[model samples]
Target: MQDNSPAQPAVDLRGVVKRFGTMTAVDHLDLTIRSGEFFTMLGASGCGKTTTLRLIAGFELPTEGQILISGQDVSDIPAYQRPVHTVFQSYALFPHLTILDNVAFPLRVRRLPRAEQRARAMAALEMVQMGRYGDRKPSQLSGGQQQRVALARALVNEPTVLLLDEPLGALDLKLRKEMQLELKDMQRRLGITFVFVTHDQEEALTLSDRIALMQGGRIVQLDTPANLYNAPQSLYAAEFIGETNLIPARMVSADHGSSVVEALGQTYRAEGTTASAGAAVTLALRPERVRREPAGTGPVGELVEIDFIGTDLRLTYRMADGSKVIVRQQNSGGIPPAIGERMPLGFETDSLRIFTS
Candidate 1:
């Protein structure tokens, strides 16, 4: 808190690196998190998302570089000394302590008065709607309730930043979705910076203001959910963020703000492609973007199978060139597909993303 720069970021990592023996867990990482930002670190297992989080939490000191909290360097500070609190997958609540005392644990550690601690703990529980259960033990609460109590405990400290390491990972599908919304709402209400680490793509996309997709100890892409999904810069990013068909294409023409490419045995115009003529590239098109043509008017592709996925239908069509194209059709007041010999698929020009090889 001592060091102040003009409008400093809430959390800043300057070329941060963490190594365990010969293996580097976090690479030369540089990140700046603005105040009240909900930044998520997303990746698969062993992709260093959690490690990067620990580096920020002061649980694991970086092997190199500096960590700044609100512009003050805190690289050498211990976890307890840092103005941050962590909520892990495991609730880690006290089994023997009452809910109120559990939430007040941090204040108790700081030697705060019992009256003030109780007041803060109750207020924290109220935020999570668990004030009624203040006298109950953690063992008496359900999984979701316990998780909320854990959140209450972490929030009672009112730290400069809140680090969540897959806190909703332990919940079931329904509960997890509910918790994701609740957590995001809480962050907005508190107006505190949140550094969340999760492997779940849907969770990251739904809750994060911006996501850092890490791979092999490095951030592969850092952007908003829509931008990362729509305009990925690389093949890995395009494929990893969501379901998209990557069609190999050759750029036949390039123009300002738009380009034409040959894909799937046909010519297609794409926008935002910067490839020169005759450049080989991968064209990304989402299944939802592919529209269905009237009976015989769409691309002539044999109907393979149609998957009825509740609200939407996914049609797998085999193109004439032996390549399969997946089409997502909305079940919106239209007759479903029948077993036909061939069907057609069309999409908008802007939906086609061109990535040069």
Candidate 2:
């Protein structure tokens, strides 16, 4: 079989491992990020997402294996020589300099002609829609505006890959959402590779073309947002990517298509993987996919709490097994169930995901 990988990945890590003394910061990891792709490395704290980004940026040297950029081995290259730029969360613009000078600093360091540096800086600021504010100092701008200047500084060089280490972490919730949309738009327009490191699952889902969910210094699952959310391969993926109700079950049978599982003393069919008959498994179900009907129809639960979010109503129920089942219902203008009433909860077979425990 001819290996039909990319002709040259924008960034490739082959069995790369980085250890700080006795502790392994990055386990043996192999990854390939394609050109012009917005790839996010998402995980909890101490999961090695940032370390992997540093390895790609040549900030940290790997103890074993090789790193490649565009098919060339760059394991020995220094950070200054690498065709990559990093945007940290701190928005590290020079406080004493104007926005234009801050963005032009990179070009000036290379000894480019003064005119060219100024033109490039102005163009970069224009790209971020901060051209009119070029004369303002960093202290005069808001947090969002300062971050935009930092983005312009990173873009001025037109690097092959831009590594962002939680660049939106410092912003508030409302501004974070706005910046998420802006960053996505910017990446699509620029068409350059983006390796974003974030521990926030929603941020990864909102911004990435694909997400690499890392755990304990290794990638646990790699897929598009929809795939990772809809058809998770493992229990960890189902729990980590979103809110999931993991119900203990016993597998009755499984094939290439679906599996028959028995849960809460009820028989149900679920999407199958490698689970076989008589094996202990768990069924992953999302809240939005479930519905509540009259009592005596399905799994019975008592309505515990109801939250009136603007667009939807979130209902929490106490299941027969003492587990809480949450249901998200759109505002259809119909009166919801009484707070103390017992109701039956039902969901479709297609939404059930099975994983061996």
Candidate 3:
């Protein structure tokens, strides 16, 4: 499973697997992250994303396969010795110590000179925009500030990679978004590789240059955010990445590059290169892609409910065959249709995604 060549990856995992007794956590996972790139491992809880992050950080050893960091095999290396630092969700700062002391602790452990340690700690704090709050204890600072201190402590060591395990989870939504941008900017400025782990799809989509989506102890999909959203290879990937309406369909006919599916008592052609005729398939249509035409204008559906989601409206409808579908419309002009109203729901063939289940 070794990907041996002249081109070395910043982080590489080959045939990586972790098992707890009969339960397989991470199953034969393989991944490669380029230098100075922001990579995210995203999945639901118990999907082994956190375990994979720990394995890379040397906090846990793989039951099988190897892990390399900057071309060096560090599978057996201890967590402290690895040239990586992790920022945990729970800040893990010392409440008794001031921010400056907390950030300086790592340097102090290395026995650096007091003057040098203070200078480095201050510089790191400045990078996180927490230089002025160095005198305050963790308790005195807000959750976001404490997180900044934790980040400062991790960065003061100048590790080659920074592992963030849901570091922004404790912050409020607005603060969390602000920190996401800040963290991305900081990572770029430092030119250090970042391996972030989170279950939040929006966070991954915003921060990651590439995301490895895990499910059921395996990497189900790995791609750039755009590709993961636009062209999912599987039903699970499509449904997990965004809001998709999975309509039951059967492949009616197929050519070299396209196929027609019969769904909701209508035959619609979809653009997929490979799918067999007579195969049971599911059509993935994004909620935003569905257009509401004039009533009785095209394929008809009854709007059963409307949800006002601040900036947008979510309309739930039922097709002629009693299949439920959701459509997201921007709330620009006025209020949307009330319940029990019928509307024409139409989508282009290009916007449809066909997957064999």
Say which candidate scores most in lDDT: 2
> Which residues of candidate 3, in runs, are more than 4 Å off?
1-6, 272-275, 295-297
Off by over 4 Å in 1: 1-6, 254-257, 271-280, 295-298
Residue-level lDDT of model 2, residues 1-357, one tens digit each, is 113545677899999999999989899999989878899999999999999999998989999989988778899999998989989789888999999999999999999999999999999999889999989999999989999999999989999999999999999999999999999999999988899999999999999988999998999999999998998888888999988888888999886666788887788888856576889988889888888877446788889999998788888998888878888889898886779888888877798988888
Q: On residues 248-286, what C-alpha lDDT tens digit does candidate 3 reach at each position?
A: 889899865577888887888886535678888889989
Cα RMSD of all models vs. native, in order, equals 3.2, 2.5, 2.9
User: TM-score, each model?
Assistant: 0.93, 0.94, 0.94
Give the top-scoring candidate (TM-score): 2
The models' CA-based lDDT, in order, is: 0.88, 0.89, 0.88
Q: How close is candidate 3 to the true structure, as a TM-score?
A: 0.94
Stretches off by above 4 angstroms in model 2 are 1-6
The TM-score of predicted model 1 comes to 0.93
* Selected candidate, larger TM-score, 2 vs 3: 2
